[model samples]
Target: MPVRHPAPTPPFNIIRMSHIELGVTNLDASRKFYTEILGLIETEQVGNSIYLRGLEERNHHSFVLTKVERPHVIRLGFKVASEADLDSMATYFGTKGMATGWVTQHGQGRSLQMRDPFGMPLEFCYEFAQAERMLQQYGAYRGCHPQRIDHFNCFTPNVQASHDFWALELGFRTTEYTVSEDADPQLWAIWMHRKGNIHDMAFTNGAGPRLHHVALWVPTAMHIIHLCDLMSTTGYLDNMERGPGRHGISNAFFLYVRDPDGHRIEIYTSDYLTVDPDLEPIEWQLRDPQRQTLWGAPAPKSWFEEGSLLAGANVQPPVLQAQPIIAS
Candidate 1:
């Protein structure tokens, strides 16, 4: 188990898990999938990149796809409380002996880029150009009608270390966790949040710094079911990888699908709120079947074995290397 420390008052403020920059091999193919099939609104296209956002999102974009030969998670983005928080973040990373740099992003203001202790690429920004929201634009709705960017799930080599840093240093609260049932158990996975939802981010015990999936919040379970039917008829049936099932952990109704670049995306809904400061994290044993899926078959090997590579980082196998039960 990871050692516990009193959660610190962070010097900087983070408002929410904001956006993501996903690198794809073929921008055109990815644009079609994310825009047409996933129902993400295409905001802009510049050179080799495409900018997109969900229907209800007012920000310029929550997702960006850039052309790259290797498909990888380019960077994760967060909304900070103020522009001064950028300097505070840089100082925080510097004190930890980690380097941070400022990068100018189109449609967004000043941003700081750095890698976490586990080397997950991250960015923090405060100002983003607002876009016209299409929430009530009934005629424009298509695919699953993604409402907004939800959360990110990452596979990490050292789950405990990752958990501690985010909880103690960055002030994230754990909403749920799983423990390996070894003689002396260890933290096998954790769901931590800055925003009031169940998770802004989750770290699962696995090989280092890989993206498990980027979840998009859809309106209802019917949206997910609609996606399944649409995919079956539109030659995207094979992209439907997992579920139309519920997770015991978050009680979230979900369906996992693969994009043109093999990056996993989860269409998610039906999770409950977790805003209470004293709310206890739901715990699950590593071998518990229900924790992985409240119903339906176990997740297949591909779901367990495959994930998008992180940009500019090398992979490291987990220290414990404990495997969870998967579909046989």
Candidate 2:
């Protein structure tokens, strides 16, 4: 089926996936992983929270780590086109019977926070504090360089409903998807994007409303390989969860690693462009092993069975469970 597009005009103009806020148990340990090892540039620190951005990002912060009792996601952030768009965002969600409110926080202005119909926490802000870009600052890179914040992949009980909310309600366009080929075929996953590359966020069939991983774009595949070598010798090899391999879905080079608090981050590169509105979304059958990894390696069980919790989300069970091919 061709992907459905929302009306040409939406209530607000969402620019792109902007940032993420995560609560971690150990601030010092998280800092060592993100800043010292992974090479995200620290922009600011306030109380128990630390603000960081990718090397090429000019936004004062694109990732926020805060000290909390548990490791959980606070919210995923989006950048709207303007302050007026921010207001429109609040109005649109509020009218939809979704929870919306203004949030006061550091490093950004006029932030609006909301929970989607599926209870995935989200925030939108128009103005952000700008910082010097570090794209050319080779010496500043501690190890593998994450150029910018990319897409987020998450687990939702109902991939179809989650896909509709983003594709038919908001204006995100699907670029790729996975479907079960059962007698009654069902969508098992959807990758939708607004930023003109591949995806800004993706939803996979699994437990309800949990973060699978947040991705950061690097310059090339070599960057990912470099990270693997760094971890292998740095006593963090155990933290490496999955690939330095290409994904059959996005066609991006990927590496998954766990932070000290076990929050997952994917170091990624090289997804194809999806700028043309007429681009047909690619489809893959659920049981096909290539859909998980293009080079034919089966995913580890943890990749499907585990995801980080969002604080107090109304979690639900998947309507239909998957029987994916996993490593033996």
Candidate 3:
């Protein structure tokens, strides 16, 4: 039997999602789409790389794009409350016999990179170069006007295993979850959070270790409409894939758009607060189609079958195989 590490006594303080690095084929076009179209502020451009932050963000960046031959997700970054948490996490994963390493990227503190029980590239670090907040610069806002990266939704073959590992070892709390109905209720998806909002990261049963979407928080549902108008008038209507609808699980209004490199980005808002540690996680049945989208249009097939492959050490990791839950 595999040994389980008890949740940290002091609980490693995972502040929130700090930033995400993505590999893009065209830096200039991607830069234009993210800055001019999506309305994220570009902090700096270093050769083939560009750094971006949201309107209300004080950090140097919440998202990054680097020119590559193809678009792919590089890493999922998280912020820890203290530097000590990095050491604790390193030791914690080390004791679990996981592959671990330290990476020192420019303008950022040392980051700990590791693959979770299931294979996914994850980085946790404490500090980064801070930037001036553009919250009051209302005139500078354009396009979709996203505020900050709200959360990441990932594809995993086994939601229950990943959810258990994240909740039991990393101290993430489940705010909501889905289970297939019938005689045996099998876990289908879960929304887990470290921050006060609904979720910092979520796992849905699918092909393993793929990123379904990265969500950028908008202030209201109207902003989601604004994105639709922006894309519609700008000749990128096809990029708009799904939503402007509410999710029954998180109660968040959402819109999904495909980036220049086919990476799915979600413009999201309006999830309820999950600050109470003792709060019970809301459960939904998989048979209820409305659970996925409260407004009642079934999710498109691409939403279920497609996702970006995880970037492994040398090549993409082979998808970890598992059976999907059947809703009876």
Candidate 4:
């Protein structure tokens, strides 16, 4: 048996998930879906790119969409603690033989862009322009009224390898995880965080380098219900893919929807905090069907098999075979 070592202190600091860029086929349709349906406030429009922010956000943007030939994920952005951390990260990743470089395209300063060992495109920055926060503007609330970007869930070929890279090397703490039922347990999925909540990111063993979903936090459980109502009334019932259900892993209330371009977005709330260094992560057995949905509803096959392709990832082969789960 391999000895379990403690997660290492990261050499560089990542503050939180700052933004995400998605490549969309129809700029106008996707913008309307996000702004009119999802309630994200448009912060700026430049050329073929549109920047958006949640109601509680003060940043110029937390989500960006670019006109592209197909729908895909461009990058996952994280804010580093300082400009110095950017320099440190560049050196750290470069020393480890990962591709690293500076990007000046996203209204950021001296940003470091790199592909992690798993080939996920990540951007790190210390500065971005701020915007007016619309948290108190009740009249401006249109749809689900998302507060902020909660977390990103992605698919990887090897959950254990990706989990170690984030939890060990990137200084993220595991809040919850699922393990296989083998006599010797194996990692099946993991939820890790840097911002003291349930997770800033999570990985499940699946197809390589695909985005499972980008989650946005709504203010309350009622907000989730309101969004479902809005979607149904607004003729977007086809977009509602799954749930107004609770998850056993994060204890979050969730509703999954698909954008016009087929990218998945999750409206979520009610996850517990996880900031203490000594806090032990909650683990779930793979055979426990409630680990995914506490309400006894099972996720559809499309939810498991469909995900957005990443723009620059070198796809890898899947390592784990899918298994049957219990459903009520």
Q: Quick one: best lDDT, which candidate?
A: 1
lDDT of 2 by residue, 1-48 (tens): 334653255877888899999999998989989998899999988999
Model 1 spans with C-alpha error above 4 angstroms: 3-6
Q: Name the TM-score of candidate 1.
A: 0.97
List the candidates ranked by lDDT, beginning with the highest. 1, 2, 4, 3
User: Per-candidate TM vs. native?
Assistant: 0.97, 0.97, 0.92, 0.96
List, residue by residue over 103-203, the lDDT tens digit for candidate 1. Answer: 99998999999988878899999999999899999888889999999999998899999888888877888888899889998998999888888899999
Overall local distance difference test of candidate 4? 0.86
lDDT of 3 by residue, 222-300 (tens): 9889889999899789998887789888989999999988999999998898887567778887757778788666677
Instruction: Supply candidate 1's per-residue lDDT for 95.
Output: 89
RMSD of 1: 1.2
Backbone clash pairs for candidate 3 read none
Query: Model 4 over residues 149-254: C-alpha lDDT tens digits?
Result: 9889999998888887786778888888888788777787888888889889898778878999999999889999999999999989999998989998899999
Worst 10 residues of 1 by lDDT: 1-10
Ten-residue segment with the worst summed lDDT in candidate 3? Answer: 1-10
lDDT of each: 0.90, 0.88, 0.82, 0.86
Candidates 2 and 4: which is better by TM-score? 2
Q: CA lDDT of 116 in candidate 1?
A: 82
